[model samples]
Target: MITLQLAWRNLWRHRRRTWLTASAIAFATTLLVFMITLQLGAYDMMIDTSLRVFTGQLQVQRQGYHAKPQMRATVPDAQALAARLRAASGLDGVAARAQGFALASSVSRSYGVPVIGVEPEFEARVSTLPHLIKQGRYLSSDQAQEAVLGAALARNLKLQIGDELTLLGSGKDGSIAATIVPVVGIFESGNPELDRHLVQLPLKTFQEVFTMGDDAHAIVVSGPSHEAIPQTQATVAAQLAPGSGLVVLDWEQLIPGLRQLIQADMVQNWITYIALILIVTLSIMNTFLMSVLERTREFGIMLALGSSPWRIGVIVLLESVYLTLLGLGIGLLLGGGIAVYLHYEGFTFPGMAEIYAQFGLPGVIHPKLSFAGFTLGPAVIFVFTVLAALYPALRIRKLQPVEAIHAV
Candidate 1:
């Protein structure tokens, strides 16, 4: 208790230096807390926005279907399965889709494209594609003999709404699939990859034209948010019958490229965080070294008055501990308060939505607070601060009482 009091008093003895060192630690902690929170929040938004554009948060497909797609590789009775799963699973939406490659033709031009059949009602709930339409309207019924296509695809084929489009492909049972439908809608996704090669048809017409019956290539599903995906996926999987040749894939499995993108961004953030910690560690070491040098005479007098050398060293260590704790407390208070405010209110930019339109990302970014976000940065600072104080504390142990007291 007496040693702690002595250490605390000595901190106030050099108030300016003590406050300066503490402020450095506090600023680092606050910056780390907020920065990590922003990264986590941004990642969540990026993933969900991308997935919602076409690939929902999760998908149910036949085993090995994703590695190599074949017309024959399909989820049997997919529509019924989707209905059952939707009623039982606590998920936001579930829908079935049939996909195939076909040669799409207008009166003058022809091109190969992916033809996807979707449920209008459920698709509106699970996908943002329906909302991207720039001309005409989305499919009105599962039975409508109409199609929606990308603007670029329509342009490539010299098509416009109400124009006839002929589709020719192979059926799931190896039969020839052919159909002609009128184009009813056109969408511009802003991504050339999607804009140039995709078309959509009513599920019922597609099933007949492709001879797929009620089977579908994939079952698309979504949850309220990315964080709920794991639980939502588990609920759907549990309801599947034993020996069902079906598997559920989350966003990561559905898009390996997106996973790689997030990892690359995380590595960049870690680099910045590491550099900040190193700077704070050096500042702490400098502060403790100065304190030890200026207080050498006081330490020597205490040693001569029957205080052990180890006791004087311990006081120095305690002083470092107190300063670190004080900084940590203030940082947590300020940073956490600001983060909480942003989390609820959100931070936005005037032109960010337009900028992100090309990739389907959100404009507003909310800072998220979690146990890891709050503890990881401050914990690293505390460990480094203790290490920084070690050399100065050890100097007190090597002091000669008579020489230290009489020299200066």
Candidate 2:
């Protein structure tokens, strides 16, 4: 207790130096927390958008479909698989899809498009297609020979809801066939690849038109929670394929680019954090060194009055710890307040909203906080303080009483 009191008094004796060192640590901690929060928020947004807009949490496909996704490559027991998936505890919903390439034409323009056949109700529950319907109505379960065109595709072909459009493509036999499917609705997915080439039809109609019978290109499964995806996928895979012949793809596997983006964001966050911590460490070290040099006479006087070298070292370490704790308390309050504010209100980048909209991403970014991050700030600062005092502690150990007393 006496050592702690003496340390506190010594720290205040050089108030400017102590404040500068503490402020350095505080600023670094704040910056580190803010940067990590922003990166995590962006990464979460990207993953959520990609999963909800493009792929569900998990997908089940035919054994060889991923390598070659032609009309012929399909899972024969897709309905059974979907049924089992629906019964699974961790799964939210399941939907089957069939995809093929065809040429679509109005009187004014013609373009090659990818046709996706989906069950209206199940697809709506699994993906964002229902919400993306910008015009008319989503495909009805009873609607036959009806098609939904992407907004960009509609613009290119000069099509509107209720317009008749001719589709030219090879049916099941690779024999060219032409069918006129009425445009039922227009959609905007904010993904150019999907918006420009995707056309939607009823699963049964697509099967009849494309000659697919009791087979599907893929089965998409949504999980009750994002973290439950892997566990649900394992359960679904086991039910769908008793053997190792089939491949189950999670959202991360389906979108390699998105996975890479998340990884890069994490790496950048760590690098930024390490750099800031190093800066704080250096500042604390410099402050400790200067304090020791200025207090040589005082330290020698204490030692001559019977204070041991061990006590002197303990005093320096205690002073560092006290200053670090004070700084960390301030930094945590600032960082925690910032994180909570951004998590609720969110941060918006004005002009970039449209770009994010085009990619089916949310305009606002909300940060999520982890308990480790909130508590780690002070713990790390305490460690740096100890390390910074090492040089000063060693210098005090070597100080000769006469030399130190006469130096100042």
Candidate 3:
């Protein structure tokens, strides 16, 4: 208790220096927490948006389909497979999709487009397509000879709801597949590529038009939450029919670009964090070194009065601990408050919607709060501050009582 009181008094004797050192640590801690929280939140948004746009969190597809998706590379009896997976645990939604390339034509214009066949009821539950409809209603299972056009596709072809569109493509067996269908809806996906060249039709219509029968390119699945995907995927993989060539892939594998983007961002962020911590470490060490030099005579007096070198070293460490704790408290309060506010209110960048449209990303970002973001910064500062105090402690141990007392 006496040693602690002495250490406490010694720290306050240099009030300005102590406060300055503590404030530096506090500032660094707050900055780290804020940046990490915001980055994590933005990543969450990106993952969800990318997954919901078209790719669900998990997909079951025929082998080699992801590498080279062709009409022939499809999951046979996909509706049966979907039914089996739907009965499994940890699954939130499941839908089958068939996709192909085709030329679309109207009375005035023609363009190449990617065509998608979907089950309206299940597709509505698994993807964002239903909610993204800008005009007209979504497709119904009974609605044959009707199609949906992306906003950009609609504009380029100069077609409107109730207009007829002609499609021409090759079927699964290299047969000529052609059809004329009425446009019933138009959707804006906020993705330039998707909006410009994507079309959707009823699964039954697509199978008949493309000669796909009941086969699908993929069976998309979604988990209740992001964290549940791995377990859900594992369970689904294990339960597949023994001779089935189907393979399960998570979003990280399906959309390698998204994973790569997050990894690259994280690497840059960690580099920045290391640099900030290094600067703060130097500042802390300087404070402790100056304090040791100024208190040389006092330490010498204690040694003369029979205080052990180990005891003096302990005092220096205690001072560091006190400063670190104080700084961490202040920093956590400020950073956490700001994170909560940003999490709820969100932030928008000017003209970001158009810019992000090119990359298929959303413009607004909301920062998320997590235990790692809140604790990592203060923990790093605490450990580094104690290490910085070690130099001063070693200097005290090496001090000669007679010379230190006789000097200044």
**How many residue pairs clash (N, CA or C atoms closer than 3 angstroms) in each of the candidate models, in the order given?**
0, 1, 0
- Which residue pairs come into collision in candidate 2? 190-358
Best of the two (2, 3) by TM-score? 3
List the candidates ranked by lDDT, beginning with the highest: 1, 3, 2
lDDT of 2 at 309: 84
Global lDDT of each candidate: 0.88, 0.79, 0.85
Off by over 4 Å in 1: 301-313, 357-360, 394-407
Better TM-score candidate (1, 2): 1
Per-model TM-score versus the true fold = 0.91, 0.81, 0.85
**Local accuracy of candidate 1 as per-residue lDDT tens digits, 355-395:** 87655566689887788778888998899898899999998
Candidate 3 C-alpha lDDT tens digits along 15-77: 898888888888888888888888888898889987888889989988888988878988998
lDDT of 2: 0.79
For 320-340, candidate 2 gives per-residue lDDT tens digits of 888888788777778778987
Please give the lDDT score at residue 133 for candidate 1. 93
What shift in Å separates residue 270 of candidate 3 from its native position after superposition? 4.5
